[model samples]
Target: HDVTADDVRLAHREGYVSVEHLKRYTTLGMATDQGKMGNIIGIALMAEALGREIPEVGTTTFRPPYTPVSIGALRGRSVGSHFRPLRRTPLHDWNLVQGGTMTEAGLWQRPWYFAQNGESLAEAYVRETATTRRSVGLCDVTSLGKIAVQGPDATVFLNRVYSNAFAKLPIGKARYGIMLRDDGIVMDDGTTWRLSETDYFMTTTTAHAAPVMAWLEELLQTRWPDLKVHVTSVSEQWAGIAVAGPRSREVLEAVVSDPTIVSNEAFPFMGVIETHLTGEIPCRIARISFSGELAYEIYVASDYGPAAMDLVWGIARPMDGCLYGLEALGAMRIEKGHVTAAELDGRVTIEDAGLGRMASTKKSYIGSTLRQRPELMREDRPRLVGVFPEDRGETFNAGSILCAADNVAGLGEGWITGVTHSPELGHWIGLGFIAGGHGAWYGKTVIAADPVRKGNVAVEIVSPHMIDPDGERLHG
Candidate 1:
């Protein structure tokens, strides 16, 4: 607003002797003029107050757009849908051709569900989820964040950033790992494959791709400059497709150049292999499952993505397989109680998300010490658990509050993070966090209270792995 020499003097007396400090304390140079008209006067005043030369007093740094501009000029060419650019995967058009309904994941438009015979959203997803478990299903997972980490120190670097141990990870094997922020809260979780002694490939959730990459760069440049590691984002270089279901291996065996490599004894779960499809297109196959079924994720060059999709679809279709989408993928993961962004929100700790066992105790990692803070170690903190409707016919929405039977108001003890109609369990189920986890609430019922949506259903607490509590189906 209004500034004077007296104000500058007052700021200096208050120990704000620097020009930058004086400017902030006196609200100088922050008005409509942006200091263009008044900054020199303010500087002169500040110099006089300090009884020093104007140059000695120094001046606050100036940012660009030196002259004032109208809002219209600033908004040029950014109106409507053009406001933000959209990123598409290699299979974007192919998914649309297969009758896929698209939804936005970050800036990428991905298939939400592939409708058939005029099926509704619910109908389509249910059918897709069932078909996948019954036979085979192909899903586009190219949106996942792929990063290449190389050099001799890659292994040691990973061991420091990830909560789990990675120093001794065998080549040609992948391990699921979790990362924690400097504050000891969960940041992201993903699978990293040890391609060679000096090379590794990592896949992060789509939403955390860019941030995680930046975090890695910041750490290497500022925190551990001596470590011989180079990290690069390879997300756009490869197109990924997850072939899942009981017959997933059969679909791969039909197209892979060497069928024997797909055998369980040869490429067991969490195994990785660099192979070719149909004796031509180079690809990498990893035996990993997010649907709790026998599955493999095939990665091919971006240019060959369309061809890979066609080849896989041609073989899977005749075997009663279908093309599933994100909706169906969510259903299966929910059935198995897998955690996603909904559960790993920045507020939760590794233990809060039921991944405490994964935190390595042998070696110190990024968050190892901070994660053991007294407040974070409290047992009463919200812990991940499964929520099932007592009536089996009722359903609850994500963000619904879980409370005691008599108290349904306020934030309550916990809240639902995700919900799905589980085709495998033949009922609606949810993955949520409660005050004390399954051990404290098992065999007890809680009210799923959603005041805004007018939903209040009685849901029983149970283990998050509602469908396959054991490893039978995963190892199949």
Candidate 2:
């Protein structure tokens, strides 16, 4: 009677040798998707209650390719633009016209700024840096990963996948969230835009969008298959650009009519809205600036993304839009204490990323078990933090190991994941993960652990938030 008596009788007559055999014959839990939506224990309980053997009820052996496609095969033949769906700017044709060289700055292809009489790559970057600080600068950010997740369970799906809670995020608002591995290690961080009560868009570092989306789906389908949710990547459908600097607003306002649609009051910092910029042009814009300055990121459909970018450049050239590049963005991010993918890679945990609070330990979730281990909670772990050379003039190439060696100067220091000569700070700044770098390790010096130039590099412990000490820039 405990066994679904009606179902059991059906199985008996359906040629299933037994209840266990019935499961095998039905191929229950026998698919690559892993019967993520099926009944496993319930059937098992049915057999036990009926005094039947498990083998008589055989298990569903979910086949291989058990999870998702192999990263190598999924990546397949495509590299660069071809591999990931990228927005070729509407003015991409103009790049050929201007004889400009282009490269990836996230998922989008951005002009590395026009080459002058004879400008080399280094010269171009340096010039671009100065232009933005002194004038204005523009960047194509179309490649930042974007995904639209919809369905009634969308909110629940997002909350489970991210370390932070998302169920309470109000519609028409956005929140910055971090995703973590089952072990409480940070996997990725991104902005979640609640387009409506049931529809949402997520943007992640260009490198992790595809993987993160897949991770979310697998968890939902397998872990909570009953939840109603669908996630789709739309990174290619829209072209996005960042126009930054003190004159950024001026340049944007100059190109558009009825500036009120994209106004500072309506599209304020971290605000999300579906609206147009440039009265005649009609481009969707978000007042999100990653340059650590007042900036606007304009989004337009793929067909117009390029043209919008060109028009922006025309407006920016007069205002001195900085021909900014990846190097400069990397530097500004490090200076702002923003630990991106480089610092938050698989080796680091949420706690190490200074976002230990991001994870929810009070509730049941994946990776909640191993996260409680003493080793994981210890302070001696290779904690993520900020570091710089004590001697300003000397340079320490990144990835230099930090050592307190006795006879090492100008030698290898701690390994650097990212380093930059900051115009804002007047000294080279860097960010990286340092083993045993927190707690009593504060203020203590270390030597670069690299074998090639052992003990030459010198560094001191510092908090990761070197700039925007109190997040004044983000708030303002």
Off by over 4 Å in 2: 1-100, 104-117, 133-135, 261-263, 279-282, 361-369, 406-414, 451-455
Give the clash count for each candidate. 0, 38
What's the true lDDT of residue 100 in model 1?
Answer: 93
Task: Please write out the lDDT profile of model 2 over residues 437-471, one tens digit for every residue.
Answer: 55545767666555565336567778777875775
Q: Considering every candidate listed, which one attains the maximal lDDT?
A: 1
**Model 1 residue 19 lDDT score:** 81
The 10-residue segment of model 2 with minimum total lDDT is 407-416
lDDT of residue 385 for candidate 1 = 94
lDDT of 1 at 83: 76
Per-residue lDDT over 339-381 for candidate 1, one digit per residue giving the tens place of the 0 to 100 score:
9999998999999998899999999889899999999989999
Give the alpha-carbon lDDT of every model.
Answer: 0.92, 0.69
